[model samples]
Target: MDPSTLFAVAPTFPMDDVRIRDRSRETMLRSPLTWLPLLGAGAMGFALDAGVAGFVLLLGATVALVSRYWKKRRPAVDAASLRELIGESNAAQDQELKRIIGSLESKGLPQYSLCLGRFLFLKQKIEKDVHRGQHFAVFAQEVEKGVDGICAEVCREITGIRAREERLGEILTSRQPTQLERLESARRESHAAILHAYTSLYQVHAEILGLGSDPTERETVEDPGELPGQRLQEILGGLRDEADMIARTHARIRRTIEECPPAVEAPRPEVVC
Candidate 1:
């Protein structure tokens, strides 16, 4: 997979949408046109201020206008709040990835370890590239999301494989051959899934490494055989196929078990008198 193709398939986070909404709200708030109604109300109140009621109305309108103006102009407050939220979410995700990787490392899973090392290297490269310009930030985020997804899926499949192995071990001493076979099959499938994920991650890393930091440079570079968008679609299709295969395997196992007769324990011989 080309780095551009990987980027095209990267998952989108809600942060961009949130940022857009914040900017729109800020723009609307800062516009003088938005405050016109308040100004008109204040003017009307001031015009009628011949008694206590009028004075109170004018005071209230003045307070409201001032409060709104202060809030609209205080970009630091809004920006800080948004930044804090985003920072917290990012921190939580980072912590989760660390925890997952740590668990895998403790288990001495070499494949996961190798993938983690590669991911860390890729992450560093992404950060460095993102620093080159504001435009790269979006791409960096997308790639981060993609890599994060790969890590998560890898962890999940590995965990499933481990669980299945443990189950198989437990069932080994039992007479439930069907159950044992089902677990063994599931474990094999999980291993295959992990291999697929690893391949995808490696491909993505290679492509990302080839990416230029400059957006203009990226625009000039193109593959005539496959557009980035189409490649992404293919990647997604492959993932769906893998998922479908796993689901079908599980369903087949379930059907087989349902059709099989329950295992019966051998009766003990009668005791001697």
Candidate 2:
């Protein structure tokens, strides 16, 4: 919102490093027209040492001063080019974030809510920093942190969820028990795994946002019940596949075990007969 901030040129980070606001120094440097008049004035002042020489030198100085101020106050051609580059970069980042959200939706990932929230937060932070005309190093660091945080959080969620799903699947397959027992155990383990995944995700989310919170603590976001049915479906659909696969694999293993014949001790059994 500060106009001064918008117009101020940052020096710590070069314009090339800035996706926006970088005036091409090379182009500015290459403009020979800038020094041409001064050079001509100097030559004329030397050729004619009359009082006109002093007037010529003074006129040249005035021209130089005005040119400098004009360049500083208005956007130069090179500066406009740099601004375009910055606009492109910002647009690209925005599109990337949108793609991430869309992919999560289509994949029906269980942690969609958490993922979407992180993306939104990051997008907001990036836009704010850019608008505020913040220093380049500070802006870049914040953006980099957000990216790293997103990656870490997503990786943890995925790996943890997969591991828990596998363990539950193993339990169902290897252990022979009543249907009621199996169902109850499966439900309990699934719930634990789901809750654990959410907890871990929440912790990572908070850390990325530079907030502090216990991983075991519940989130303040709206309850699952309050979310739209379709949204919940997208979140839980992938989880359902995992549960189904585990159950099916367990059932197959159980059937194979039941059908296998046990080894017999022939001679020892004959004495009993």
Q: Please, what are the lDDT tens digits per residue for candidate 1 over residues 125-242?
A: 5434433444334355555555556554554455545544554544665677877776667666666765665566455444444443344555666565654444443444454344
lDDT of each: 0.54, 0.44
Residue-by-residue lDDT tens digits, candidate 2, 64-182: 77478647844665555665554565565455445555554555653653654564565455444433332332334333333334333333333333433444454455434453354
Query: Where does model 2 exceed 4 Å of error?
Result: 1-90, 133-140, 143-171, 175-273
Stretch of 10 with least lDDT, candidate 2: 1-10
Residue 143, model 1: lDDT of 53
- The TM-score of predicted model 1 comes to 0.49
lDDT of 2 at 134: 27
Judging by lDDT against the true structure, name the best candidate: 1
- Poorest 10 consecutive residues by lDDT, candidate 1: 1-10
Question: lDDT score, residue 234, model 2?
Answer: 41
